[model samples]
Target: MSVPSGLPQDTPVAGGEQRVLRFSIAATAVVAALGIVFGLMSGSYAIVFDGIYSLADGATSLVALLVVNLIAGYNASGSQNRRLAEKFTMGFWHLEPMVLGATGLLLSGAAVYAFINAIGSFLTGGRPLQFGQAIVYAIATVLISLGMAWYGRRANRHLRSELVAMDIRGWLMSAAITAALLVAFIVGLAIQGTSLEWMSPYVDPAVLALVCLVIFPIPLGVVRRALEEILLVTPTALKQHVDAVAQAVVERHGFLSHRAYVAKVGRGRQIELYFIAPAGWPARTLEEWDALRDEIGEAIGDDSPDRWLTIAFTTDREWAE
Candidate 1:
């Protein structure tokens, strides 16, 4: 495994990332509760959707936290725990992409459903809302969401965690949604005592529809990335880097040829390199070969638990192939 410079290799010491995620969970939970409460009080379906959205995000965050804990436990104790080794022979990297994909799908489904409801409401001439209460809720949620977003972004600069990146983006999305709601509610209130009073009833459904249109496709990118990991698709840039290193090793050592295979699964990069030694090459001690392997490892770089690197020297070209 080749870990990146200054990055923890998904070990227990990476607990700071978990703490950030927990903070996000707590913040999202509070916002969800507030959304549901103020949504009902204000009779705004848009606000209700916002609440449900936060609630769904919170649930997914809990799942993410659990996965993080499990992965940390595996990395910290797998060497000593026979059960864990047996249960996760390939490590827990696969779980990350799976959880991410499921969360994304769940979010997109909810948004689609909300979009349909919003459309139905619009068709029925929309619903009335207490713009004042809605505005208050939106302002509070916007502040909370922005705070969490900032915190997550700052924490991730050191952690460089995919989970944290997703968390930060979720918070930013929530903040944007709430900010939009605040503007709409304010506009609704502005028109309450004017010639546009008849337009008041349409505010809730109109905002809901707009929010849906904006957020419905937001999770698709997450799901796409997850699918790539799940499929063990080769990352182009990583493959190119690995290939270049393998080629260098082959030319430097006078090996007959070489082959390399690379794939990225979640946070893990799996690299396998095989070098075919010429049949008449001078023999070397096992220790010398090990030293060479270490040198090659250093050259490849990015050593980490999440990096699964296998390098082998073979006398037969068939083995390398």
Candidate 2:
């Protein structure tokens, strides 16, 4: 896959992901405020939980935005200040996974707390709510959640950002939970004049419990992925791709053997290729060797600032080993 400018498709651009996060921050702020106020007024724990969820998400989004700004300012090729360069000697790639992991952990913690509260409410014969007011809040929130979810997904088509992707998933989950709450509130309202009125008290806590249960597992994937990056695990697909390119270069250059090491951390790819030349092979000039390295780099196909490629040639097998 390739971008419009014939660049590789996975290349991260400057504005798109940040723009999406900014929009999410604004939308989440509005929702969080509304949820807190209406939840307090209507005495619905589910709405309050939703509000807190959005608040936590907003905080994480802010952190992510800060990291994004730092990364954008530290250009690999452009002029940079000595202090900033020294501070980020290893690049800001490590921060990406760290932020992602923190976001996931925070979300999971909130969900667990909410779940416990829901269980307490259920065991205590449930909590009564102003169904009419709750329904109104749910409808408005559902609409906003759906709108933001759609917007995030559309932006990700171009941005292809992991942060944006996670944000989109959050929006979708919010939409589904709020939509379910809307239906349950409607049912509770209808039962006010019937024999099933007793069941009305259980509706709020029941819905909240189910919502927490469903959303609890969702962030586990994000945590797992973040851990992999933090551990510097080599991605299987990327390793295979690098190995293929190294093999081709070795065969073409008539080298005795080659060794390749690759690892991915967030958006950064680290690759090292070492080739052992045959004993008594014809000597090549430094320029020629550099040209060969360039050729191999081009063949590897990911030419971006975040890519760290190192190629070495030596007649000593120990070096390649």
Q: Using TM-score as the measure, which candidate wins?
A: 1
- lDDT score of model 2? 0.85
RMSD of each: 2.6, 4.0
**Alpha carbon lDDT of each predicted model:** 0.85, 0.85
Clashes of each: 6, 0
**Clash count, candidate 1:** 6
Model 1 regions more than 4 Å off: 1-13, 77-81
Give the per-residue lDDT of model 1 (tens digit) for 231-254: 988899988988888888888989
For all predicted structures, in order, the TM-scores are 0.94, 0.92
Please report how far candidate 1 places residue 308 from its true position, in Å.
Answer: 1.2
